[model samples]
Target: MNQTIQRRLYKLYSSSSRSSFGLRNRISSLGWIVVCGLPLCAFMASMYPRDTFFQLLGVVSAVCIAAFVSVLLRKAQLKVRRLLPRHASVGRPLEYTVEYTNLAKRGLNNFYMLDLAPDPTPSMDVFLHATEPGEEKRNAFDRFFLAYRWNWLKSRFLLMKSKLFLANSVGGEKCGKVRVELLPLRRGVIHLQNMRVVLPDALGLFQRVKRVDQEEDILIVLPKRYRMDSFDFAGQARSQVGGDSSTSTQGQSGEFVSLREYRPGDPPKHIHWPSWGRTGKPILKEYEEMFFPRYGLVLDTAVRAEQEEVFEELVSVAATLTSEMDTDQSLIDVMFIQQGAKVQTVGKNVERVEAMLELLASVEIDPVADWAALKNAVLKHADDLTTCFLVFGDWDDERENFLQSLSSFGISLVVLVVQDEENPVKLNSDYTEITLLNVGEIEQGLASIHL
Candidate 1:
């Protein structure tokens, strides 16, 4: 397709999608009556058997035309406020309440409210470049024109289900509450900005839609998580500096050894009030060296386009470990590479595990694996790590080299390779620490691990 023509077609396709959704949602039961009568009206009018047939068609057409005009005659103003939850997970129903206040003098009646999320429209460049999986298998016309590409992008956004809630009435200068439930199709932030309120006329043929500008708020949708049992990993805990105190932001802390005069830079928490009161001077508590174990959770972001599902399964696998692990015993570092290697820690005194879940929720696949950078990121903290759990979409040379590199530092390694049934992974016979998990068989594969 020509670039200029595709750009024009993109605009047409986008407008058509929005118009289709609007027309379908704004029509009432009586509206369908007019639609069903159209064919009959055409057939009867064409028969020419009698003048009465033409007269009947004219009468029906006038009524439908009058209803359309009547539906457009009404006016309304409303203030909408939507209450959203702090977080929602994919495949879960996010139920919230919407409060509508009548801002106009007249009472609002026989209306419904339709909650909306931002449309996930694909850019022209993406539409042109990205192909739906198996797109080449389609017919020549479809493959040439990219017909399914439009449907794929539309379907991706439309996967979220939000229903219209009916309301009998809301009196003038009054508020009404309607519960709205939305099933999120994907994980990430759901931005709520505008809502649609439909007011149907007495005939119920059509409705007047009023757009309400809502105060934009976001709801974080966490990635799907699987139920996991306690499991042991080949990774071991390494002795950490300041022991458990390493988990806290304070410089260094351990068991009480003695009391010392307060230094200018001593943390507030380390101040000994009793000793200070006894000596009539500021004093600080000193402690001995400590030992705390930490673990590393490495996720391979190097994914090919065909292995998108494998990547999702890998994330769920990582999420399962992140949420199910006993963080109290140690700190966990979730590491992945996007443009560069990044690591975030979760455990006692650090960010909660939910924080890591949020990261996984938004993590995208790196275009290419900078294995050197990722290894360096892990190696920087290798001394504090007891063991490392690695998740990969493929067991290739890059991954095998990565494993060997980390193992060289004496870090116990457990590698999980998500397999695609169409292209089964070849297990390296020498590596016994590898776990093979099929794409759709994740639950059963992980079921074998228990403490």
Candidate 2:
């Protein structure tokens, strides 16, 4: 095995004492030490007259007993391996099992284990129990190696592994491992760190916790869901300069068209069979390709649209729109209002629009910049923009002017105002105003815009 691989699999050292604190171990240790020391000290004071040698013998006796107990403890080693789910989806519950094996000479009786998880993993229920020798259990709590406890004092051993447990005998002694399964509730990359296993000495006294050195990382990506419906491409097919009508966007009706005579290098689908039959020549059937009107998703990513969740909804809407365009083979463009410089697409590539949406997820809205400047930048691609979806938190006179002038460009417009109810500026309502109370409504409401 590689050095890096070994480091990830078998690490069992702790750096700080404070990192291993648990309530049960502290109380037991304190009680035992106090009980063992107070009586011995009082006896030594009374016996000093008889012989000071006896007093020295008492202190040595305590040291010997502690050392003997420490040496008597069975040597234990813990191993952790992560078994992740093969098929996982974002926002869905996915199981991740952490299997722990204990190779101790005796059972780790009533030990409490806590797994350290990073931010991405959702909260999970965990249990530790020793398995019987040669026994294999799958998703079963009855075979756990250690007992769990709610708190130190109310701790009681039960076979159920609800809050406490006792490790079953392994080989000739108590040993073996337990598996903890976790459900990931969110999408993106997740990293799992080392687990801290806390075990106290006999009689539930003096807890000692050891950190396992294993590390696990997993990635969960959500599949894209693209939409295909209600798009206009009649005028676009007719405008293709060199591409064939069957493969082109020029047409008057939004329907599939038939193929004509095939050129030398024409796509096989474009070869018209019926035309070839009637005229004894090859022809192809061509469907009119649709193109969605380009709309600049100008998010006020400046200081105003600082709420990350709200920004994500805008990006989600943008991504869904781009995916729809890609499915329909339509044309749409995007631009950011507060990104210092203008951003846009040249022709009808929906992939370019998807990239722009990802950019919107990180961009911050600016309040100092002039909205007019951004509007003018959009004018450079004014002929291409079918409409503008201005996602902002507030309404202003300048925004009204921008929308009013857009009608002259022969484009439809929709203004999505995402703001609190206490927004001071009353909207003029010259154009369609969608007050975004919830960000999720943006996509559903966008369908109403006929442009």
Candidate 3:
């Protein structure tokens, strides 16, 4: 019975306003009404006759009822379509157009529209961090007092504050457009659900809303990218033994090959003017394999329960490097383990920067075996790579040994270990390639690195 009541309350809160003000706003408005109305009623009772005071109260109640009825009787037929981008980025504002067509005979006025965006999934870290004995006991004690449920309710209300809302007025049988702006707080798939339209009474005391069901559209928000212009990886491109030129970027010295479609980062001088004249399309001349610098991006996916934030910082670092590094000059192979060992190449005409960030946004922490699998996957390309960037969640003997192994294989290594405050930044003076970055201070760390 308590659960049922909570559910009903939640529904009422969600439906109260298109702005998503929820129950808190409703209660505040009621309090203000009583605070002001009671004083007026008391003054009238003292100064005016009893009959007059009662008549004034009755007139006010009738007016409120009439206003509510006016809104309740209103009917509108609306057709809505969302024009959104293919993807959005975290902490960036995403603007999309919502086109609405009013099919009702009468116009709509003082109505607000809200796009129903799904909530983000809770991270496993939240549950795992609370698994300690003391924490668990505290949680059990809180549950006994129903504090857990209250906390959940508070979280739900806070989540509603992030929803997007727009207000507009449209004439009968006319088309209107509303630009909606949303700032995503995290990286994930943002699913757009139904749209709610709230029509308030003329007095603005009550609102009646209608929900227009929409075909869900999913938008993936990529992880945040930072500036890493000062960072550099030293390497040399290996010669291709056989097959076609596998280099994604243009070679500094190579024989001219056949002409192909032009890529975004391709140098303008490489454009084949003759081919463009003949084919009436932009084309670029390919080149033989030359000194193509190939770098391996080794991402550590094995994160402990409490290291989720560090893992997220690792991902953002990868994304930043992927964006800042000129793929037109070198090839970067991003290697990580999801369900299994997977490698994604970004350089030349292989893949775009957006594709790489999308992959990073969805990567989750895996088991230790998965990390081992990633090592094996990188070894397969060992011969081709001249340098490797190792991004680790923590630095232990196992990780140190792995870096040493890579160094022994003639592969120059640049290591970045993400650490928390409790874990002080410690560097082995012997390994010049290693750098320690505290979580949330990545920009400062990168700027401090001279090479």
Candidate 4:
């Protein structure tokens, strides 16, 4: 992951390009509009002096000449190289570098530089303005002397540096880490397949644009944080303080469950020779696997807050737990809170949960989701499972009722709730619950839970 990110940044820093036709056309159109229309418009206005037309023409001509000169000076290939951090996490700062040279023959004066960036998605069309060059000193502020000429005969090169941070926009405030990268502009199609721009127009008009072309782009991606605690899962397991389905016996002895006639496919170690001899046939022994009685995962898409991050963490936890239990003959299942489908009786390498993660990552939040209907669906499904791992946040009356219904079904429930700052969950119930702050804790937390 680190190598892949570093290579992309390196490529951007080493790349360069000459001015495009689009830039030339826009600048020319603006200059011509003022140069050709100003004198005519001033002549029509009765309030101005009769000689104003001449003065306007001279002023417009000089401005047009300056515009043409600036365009000639601005034609150059800009090479940008940014340095980004490895092992990227949520709410962490990333660093990058920007480098470019003035490829024109003469010094480009009074011009600002802007790099195009990518859009964050859906209906919000916005691009990152990586760096902005400050305006040069106005020519009017210069001091001139007799017999002295300005040294404007030779072309010059330019070097500028800049930085930008990556963050999440919540309640109109940006939060999270500063991310950076360096990539060299090259010959290939640098597809910022998802690019957009929200910027001021030539006349200071605010315009939002989504770019869909073969060129011009920016590099910025959202982050995922690394955490090491699992309060929800652990709390769920400990909730059963004194029950018949408590912790397994400490001894290594396997508990007996039943016996059956042995077939050719039965393992040799599991064969009960004595019992087989009495019946003149082979018999096999079976043991009930010691495990948490019920483990259920509930995915509440109704909680639209930070939906993407929540989805990632939920999927990571489910996948890790499923993989661990599979190795030890433990059963697991995942239930979607809103979606009717549930991943039940999950075996090794269950594909349903994997599919769920991808779906979750892409799903956008609908601010007006129907929580009542979602709760009803969960209540109906909770009746059939013996042990379930439920993943969710704070509950209302409907969720509380569904949880209470599990008690009658003899189900042992373990809940893994994703943590939030202002909405902390209380350890108020006997049912085991674990709170996961971020995806980083999934592996370590599973290692500590035996059943």
Candidate 5:
């Protein structure tokens, strides 16, 4: 997230490109057409001094100046309030309503509202490490200058069509609602900084933007979920010892089911004294096994810079699996490594599936991450997990050994290696429950997979 050479280049390109687009949007379609030809007219007039191009250029420039001035003088007093949803998804278009209360004495016309947000530029670390798809095949200048990479990373944060039409007219001291749609380019939270009310001139040559309000709002953009109609966790209860006991009201007494005639060697604590008193013979309280089947969703983070796309695909797959799992029937422990080992559980007695997805949305790739971190995390709860799904960025000896060790722990293994079609990854050995999912064809592979 620092300002490295790569990050600087990215920031430079992002700023220039956004500025160009903002200027283009500020100018109306007619104004842009004239402006585009104005430079050509100037060039022609320079080449042929007595040409009519000079007069045309002068007239267009004068009109643009007057229009710009007209917009600058006209001001709109408006307060903006936004109604945003709690969450959004990457690549999905989401709509929200914005209320504009006009504070001016007269009605305003031909204006729109634009949401302001912090620059969605990638951090220095991200800019330097993550390679844009087909980046190597680009021209020498583009590859060296990182123009392709810059735009690709920046696009991840941009809210498409941030500009929304307010209304043709809004009366003084009145409120108007405008439905605005924005496409999220990336997962994680988008920090909306402020709102702007754009006032255009009669000719619509330029726009005067007024800062209506400064309010920080956030939209949690969930990861892209590759819908899987069927995915089997292949989970089995690890232990029947405490099945539903922990969730019961009288947890210390286990999950009570019924009472039976007391048998030899029955614990006195299990004896139903009231029933015993009524029947003259002792009775014991019976309890059902309480443990829910728990499975591990392991997300491997040891990814290289060139495999950023693979990491993203991996996260999306993990997120999709999390969404598809029936948490009510089983427990899922999402395991990954950050600075250290981390694990989050979601199920009947744990957090919700949404919480797990939200956590996955924030997962980032660590090129130097140690496999031991994930192994340690998984082993910590291995005794309770029935099966483990290892979503790996790449397949190597380390990951293979990790699986073998899990086998020693008697955990069923399902290895899913996420890679690009251009550069496919191979499993080190012939193993059961291993699925190779290409970047673009993950869903097909998922569907065809039996377990």
Candidate 6:
């Protein structure tokens, strides 16, 4: 009962805040009409008391009323369609075109259109609660006056009130296009709700809004990627048939398999001299494929409620490594526990990078995911992986034991532990691949990895 009441209270507050913002904007738009029109009409009537001026005032008032009524009655028969990309990167500006077609017989004049965008960033209330008590207390007043609460409220209202006027006239039975640019401040899914058209009176004193619902376009904003030149892991390459021979080829550089007719781009070194001399034709030597490095990226999704920010940093690190690694030359396997333990494999030839990023964009902390299940998932792929990159939020004993167990499998392991400034770096003498990185200085820590 208490939870229900609290929820109701929150909903009420949110609705009231949004309504207040809309009211403020509406007043600002028509404030001059009320402030000047009423007094001028009264003053004119008082001074002229009879014919000319009073009659002129009545005529002006009637015209204003007729214009307001016409605007209110005007029906905009518009078809709105949006063209947007499938994905966006964080901190990058994305531009999409919105096409509006006037299907009515009469043309639309002096009208504005706006695309409704939903905010995906965390709310101010969540941010305040995430901060320490001292910090929260220090900024309590600012939070009340200068926080995103009002901004979100205003934005929510403007989605219904504000719009972009068509610079050029949209004739009847014609189509017009407008481009909208949005800069995503964070990583998440942004839902494009609808397009709103506002038709205002001749004097621009009153606006009539029409909302045209479109198929919701969901844009996944990927996490920011960092530059990583290379990642080196300590392990012996496994030999496999039909595998890349760049890293694990044994004997005289490569094992020659067969000779084939030389192609235009065939290197001179690969040309079989004996075959060319015997057959009197250009021949190229084919070698057995070498082993390609396969790396496992284990993301620790088990985070405490308060340590959500740490998980975000861990995700960014994972995304950066995933982007920088040569998927074409090597295979990357991403392992994380969502509902259950799951693994996604990506390679140079595959177009799964966007899928992987989409998964990462919506990943949330799941405390219920057992550590044993996560361990088993990684172990299942141990034989195929040449090296494994483990991104963890905390370096607890359980996690250390998990890494130790992975190291026992002889697969090279690189562990990146995200910690706060207060937590001193803990050196692990048992493993050579462990690197401690403060959440504030991830780039420096990643750059310091020598092996």
Candidate 4, residue 197: lDDT: 17
* Preferred candidate (TM-score higher): 1 or 2: 1
**Candidate 6 stretches greater than 4 Å from native:** 1-8, 24-75, 119-167, 204-206, 229-287, 348-351, 420-433, 438-445, 448-450
Best by TM-score: 1
User: Best to worst by TM-score, what's the order?
Assistant: 1, 5, 3, 6, 2, 4
- Root-mean-square deviation of each candidate, in angstroms? 4.4, 16.5, 8.1, 19.1, 5.5, 8.1
lDDT of 2 at 295: 47
lDDT for each residue of candidate 1 in 1-451, tens digit (9 for 90 to 100):
6788677778888898789878887776678878688679779878766788788788888877887888788777888888877888888898898888889888987788887767767878888778798888889888766768888876665536677788658888898898888898887777877588887766788888889756887888888887755465432233544344333122243578888998898788989999888999999888885545577899988988767788888888888888876665557898998889999999867889989998998898886889999999999888777668888888778788888888888876777888999988876646677788998888787877532
**Candidate 5: Cα lDDT at 58:** 90
Model 4, residue 291: what's the lDDT? 38
Residue 390's lDDT in candidate 1: 89
- What's model 4's lDDT at 186? 15
Considering every candidate listed, which one attains the maximal lDDT? 1
Clashing residue pair totals per candidate (backbone < 3 A): 7, 34, 2, 47, 3, 4
lDDT of 4 by residue, 345-437 (tens): 443233443333333333333445454554454455454344566655444454555566655566566656655444444445545555444
Instruction: Please list the residue runs of candidate 3 whose C-alpha ends up more than 4 Å from where it truly belongs after superposition.
Output: 1-67, 119-140, 143-165, 233-290, 422-432
Candidate 6 residue lDDT tens string, 245-320: 4442222234689989999986788898988999999999988655556778999987775575688888888898
Q: Candidate 5 has what TM-score?
A: 0.81
- Distance from true location, Cα of 53 in model 4, Å: 29
lDDT of 5 at 415: 80
Residue lDDT tens for model 2, 1-451: 2444323222211112123434443445554665566567667767674556566557656654564475346244666566765434323444445555665554454555555434211111211122222234323342231112111111211101112223333442333555454443333334556456655555444555567546665534232222335544333334553332343231222445655777788678557666788998878666664444444555554434234345445544555555544423344556655536566552343345434443443455455756667777767767655455666555667666766776567655556655433333367765654555355455445555444
lDDT of each: 0.79, 0.47, 0.69, 0.40, 0.78, 0.69
lDDT of 5 by residue, 145-176 (tens): 88777778777656543655666578988888
* Candidate 2 backbone overlaps, count: 34
Ten-residue region with minimum lDDT total, candidate 3: 120-129
Better of 1 and 3 by TM-score: 1
The whole-model C-alpha lDDT of candidate 6 against the native structure comes to 0.69
Q: Report the Cα lDDT for candidate 3.
A: 0.69
Residue 313, candidate 1: alpha-carbon lDDT? 87
Task: Give candidate 1 regions above 4 Å deviation.
Answer: 48-63, 157-159, 230-272, 275-292
